[model samples]
Target: MTVLEQTGRRPAALAGLWGGLALTSGVALTATSGWLIVRAAERPVILTLLTAIVGVRAFGMARPLFRHLERLRSHDSALADLATARTEVYAALIPLTPARLGRRSRSAVLAGVVDDLTDVVESHVRVRVPVLSAGVAALFAILLTGALEPGAGVLVATWSALVVLLARWGLALEREAQPLLGAARAEVSRAAELVARHTPRLQAIGAAGDVLTRLDAAHTGLARALRTQSRGRALVTGGVLVLTGVTTVVMAVIAGRAELPSAVTALLVVVPAALADTVLPFADAVRAQARAEQSRAGVETLLDQTAAVADVGRGRQSSTAPHLRLEGVSAGWVEGRVDVGPVDLDLAPGRRVGVVGANGSGKSTLLAVLARALDPASGRYLVDGRDVTELAADAVRELLAVVDDEPHVFAADLRANLALAQPDASDQDLVDALRVCGLESWFDALPDGLGTRIGSGGRGVSGGERARLALTRAVLSRRPVILLDEPVAHLDHATATSVMRDVWAATSGRTVVVVSHRHEGLDAVDQVIDLTPTRKD
Candidate 1:
């Protein structure tokens, strides 16, 4: 379902009401100011003009006042909707987490989701409220003009229709540009993120120039898309002004022929000019609508994916340490493309296994299947001799602690960061875990020790430190089974070897599986599984 459909109606209604009032006030202000000026020009008595003077002042004041309220109501409603939509989207993504998200560049896909949600929710404020407000103001304009003269009313309605048509044309243009704009933006984000996260490595390997060239190309594409999208808004903006100028002249001519009073004629001529603010926003609203539609489509498509693994029931929860086994297991991340294994594996309690393969050999895919993030397509995956498919997914997940390469370090205190893995762990327990993962020196160097803030906007951590921190978290969790997917990939050979030594020491009695393309950490494993493709024929 679209984010707009899920938003609360009451707030939307309140926003519309305030918006309508604000727009109506603007129209009234323009019309009254014109009438007051023309009446004064007639050399009427001051008392005769008092009512018009008061109306002009009232409308001028009410316009800003109502507009302020409209902004408050609309923004508040949009923010509330944003919060709810984010919560729902996060929940919906749990089952599809690592597997269905994609094999590579998952961070970019997830980032796109975040951006899309913001656009979808902002539609209420940018498109819906403005459209409603403009509609109300237009209706008031038509009714008031009709009360004065039916012919003028007909002219106003016709002008309003033309404005709508212009808006529709703009919307069509924006809709055509939306996909290109969205794709360009996503590409830019992915390329920028890659460069930002791995600049040093790229430079060391002499690929920095190549990566930067790609980033420039992505930025250029994004700029082109944005320029294309803006053409629609430009057309509508110019159209509205031209239409308003023409309508004002037509109204002036109509009033002259009708022999209306000078004040009434002035009001009629000013009506079109007054409505310009109301109709001009239609261009922006159309663009917003197009963006929201594109965003909604992406969000819905991702959320619509069938989970990689389904929860059968709340199956058996292991009371003691769990034993896992994969029999003739072949798992594919995307349907119809087998990425990993048609091999047998057994892990009794406390066994350490290392999985090694070159790129595309599916070492990570095998780890994913073991982590139960992906279900095996053609094999029996059993935990404690019970099929994992029969057991509750959460129950199986509870037995494993996973540390992947890009482990997030939240912008929080060192204690809070470690506490996420084991919320009930004591500070001393955290320190112990950190020490075991070879972060003892780093922890000691912290100005506030466990209380020191880290992650973004805090103390800078090195790549090796980040890897160790992730291992610390896994050690703190103390789950029986630990899955490490290149947890030490970012570190140098010596550091990777040292971290693996610490890993073996810390997870001494736990069932563990480490997946890496590098051989640096293989020495600590009880057994190594090589997934390099071999010709059978």
Candidate 2:
């Protein structure tokens, strides 16, 4: 089903109603004004002209009034649909988070989803309202002119068909250009994000020039696609104006031959000009339709995958620190590509295990499975000797706290950011958690301490600090199992070792699983599991 169809029908209908009224009023005003002017030129008696004068005045007033109402209704409906679409899409993505999203650069994928949703929802206002309004006004014109003179009616009908044909051609062009446009946009986004987040590092490593070159290339491609798309709209716009001119001349000639009344002839001549406003917007509507179609396809593709795991039942909660085990557990981010495991492991309470593997050997994948962010494709992942697949996913998640390399620092007070891990935590508890994560010096340096606002728009956080902040949150959660997925990956060797030291010191009594390719932190763990896959020749 189309994305527009998924947004409820009532708002769309109301928008159409308002838009149609506005367009109809404008056409009527133009036609009546033309008739009034012609009748006045004939020196009609004042009394005889009263009705036409009153019609012209009423139509003129109604035009703006209806247009104002149309604007309000259309925008309100679009915003409402946007709100609903965002909520529904977010809910649908919860189960697919991190795994189906992508192995890396999940934020970029999510950002694309947001853009697509906006495009799809915006179609209600941009495409549907305009098309519906034009359709209604054109129908009114056809019926009115047909009653006055069948020849004029035929001329208008033929002109309308040509306009529709033009719009269709424009839509085809826009559709053909959409994929290229979308790719260009994605490249721009990826490049911009990379530069923004790592500008200093890129420059320090002397790779800044290469990244900027890529950004320039992406922008150039985007410009070319936009130019191609604009040609379609230009064709439609020029065609509509040209057609309107031809139709007006044809109507005037036909009216003269029919021996129509002067006022009627004037109305017939002016009708095409009035209809130009309605027809011109069809170019924009066609372009919007093409964009909406592409965006809808993207949203559908992302949401089509089945959830990684099912919530079978609420399941029994673990009493104290429960035993977790992975027995020959094989899993993959994508189907039919098992990237990790066909092995055995056990996690007793308070056990500290480290996972080490080369790139693509699936260190993070194993951690994701353990953290309940992913489900195993084969074999059993048991919690307290029972298969976790039979239990509620949320219940399994509740027992674990995850600290990944990239942890988001929300745009709020320092207290609120840390409080996400433990909402009921006191200020002292928060401070202690930071101290344990080796952020004590940084916390002390903060001007507002716990009240400091630090995120996108607030105080900047260094990479090491961000990693420590994540560790602080994990420490505060007090979950039985703390899964660290390369939490210190971004830090230098010395800092990584220092952070790992504090991590081990902070979570001394919990079941900790640290996944890392670096050897800096592995020495502190009780056991190290090497995930290097054995190849059979």
Candidate 3:
């Protein structure tokens, strides 16, 4: 789907028309001022001078009026189109979410997508407006000058064409430098991220200097790439200034040679100078176009894949006590490679299973499969004696609640955060879930109980509270199966143990599978399965 504004063409065109009128008013203002000054010097009649004064005042007032209208129309159109484009891009992004977003932190990938989408939408205002306004102004100047003096009109047209050629060249230069600039910036970011995240490890390995040297090198490269990018803008600006000066002088010569009146000649001579303002903004517009193109390409590349899991099956619901079984289920984030599984397991109702493994053993990947966030490469994932692939992914997902290490609490009141799991849940239900998940004491301490704000920019929550809040969501969801993928991984040993005790208690009578690389709370599980990845052929 095209994220750029296609449907709002009429409004954009109307905005451009207003912009053209504003620019035309400026051109007329300049020309009429020159004529009025020349006519006054010649001691023209009071009546003639009166008309010139009124014309100048009219043009001056019209310029700002048209400009205001242009801004209102253009901004309203751009904002409406931006809203639509963002919605389309976000909808496209939903299916590919966590599984296809790669192994890097989801925040970084998602943040980049948001930035690119904004850049794409901004093209309408930055690139389209300037181009259309310049076109209108240039066309008016050429026609008005050509009517009085064809030679002057040809000069104006040539200057406009040269300006366009220079802009195209600058755009090409900017495009060429884009990939190099991106690579250099990415290298700098990588170096900085490495230093920030692993400073102690690098220092311990006695490689801090080397990492610093690499970081310095990355910065140097980034500076060099930036210099290269600026050349395009410089070329467009310098070339346009030179061309405008030449056009203005030529316009004077043509007006001096023509048989027009002295006042009219003065008007003709200054027309090119007035139109210079219309053409000079092309440099910035060209650069915005190049950036928008790059951003659009980046967004397309990031989203140009089939979803990792298909969701085309019938929406089948399971019993209150669902039985989840994974038989030889192997899956990977990328194709043709197995990241986890080829193991067998059975989860009857209310059975608690603990999954333990080293970092690369695919403990989280197993939980993802059980939660229907991933489809197995080979083997069956059965829910209530039926292959899960036969059921809609969302339907299967609804039967399960999966909590990961990082639980996000939105910036809202205490009750609003839990209500997302059960949108129609009552105040008593919310209070009971929080009480069951060991947040009773914390809730009571709140100044406003359910109305107490939490999450970002709100009240701060401890690591233990965050974990319990996630449990409260699961309890509120009332899903038959609870899947915990390192939910307590961030907590200390004692906190992790206490949180797990609450987790098990809150999820009573529900099938539970907890995956952990650490052994903080494995003792409470009914069965602890140690996952060791088998070597591939």
* Candidate that scores best on TM-score: 3
Model 1 agreement with the true structure over 1-537: per-residue lDDT tens digits: 755476846676677778888899889888988988998898998999888888878988887888888889888888888898988888888999887776456666777788989999888888888888888899999999999988899999999999989999999999999989878987998899889989999999999999999999999999999999998999899999999999999999999999999999999999999899897888889998898898898889888999998777578775568878999999998889899989799999989999987889999889889888898989899888889988989999889999998888889999999999999999999989988888988888999999999999999988888988888888888799999999888788888888888888889899999998888868878899999999799
Q: Model-by-model lDDT, in order?
A: 0.88, 0.87, 0.86
Q: Give lDDT tens digits, candidate 3, residues 380-460.
A: 988888888789888888888988889888899988999999999999999999999999999999999999999888899
User: Candidate 2's residue-wise lDDT over 1-537, tens digit each?
Assistant: 344466836676777777787888889889988998988999978998899889888888887887788788878878888887888788888888878886446776778888888888888888888887888889999999999999988898998889999899989999999988888887898899889999999999999999999999999999998898888888899999999998899999999999999999999999999999987888888888888899889889888888887766668665669899999999898989998988578999999999988899989889889878788989889999888877888888889999887899999999999999999999999998998888989999999999999998999998888888998898899888999988878889888888888889889899999988888878778899999977899
Task: Assess every candidate by TM-score.
Answer: 0.93, 0.89, 0.95
What does the lDDT read for residue 301 in candidate 1?
88
Residue pairs of candidate 3 with colliding backbone atoms: none
Instruction: Sum up the clashes in candidate 1.
Output: 0
Give, for candidate 3, the lowest lDDT window spanning 10 residues.
1-10
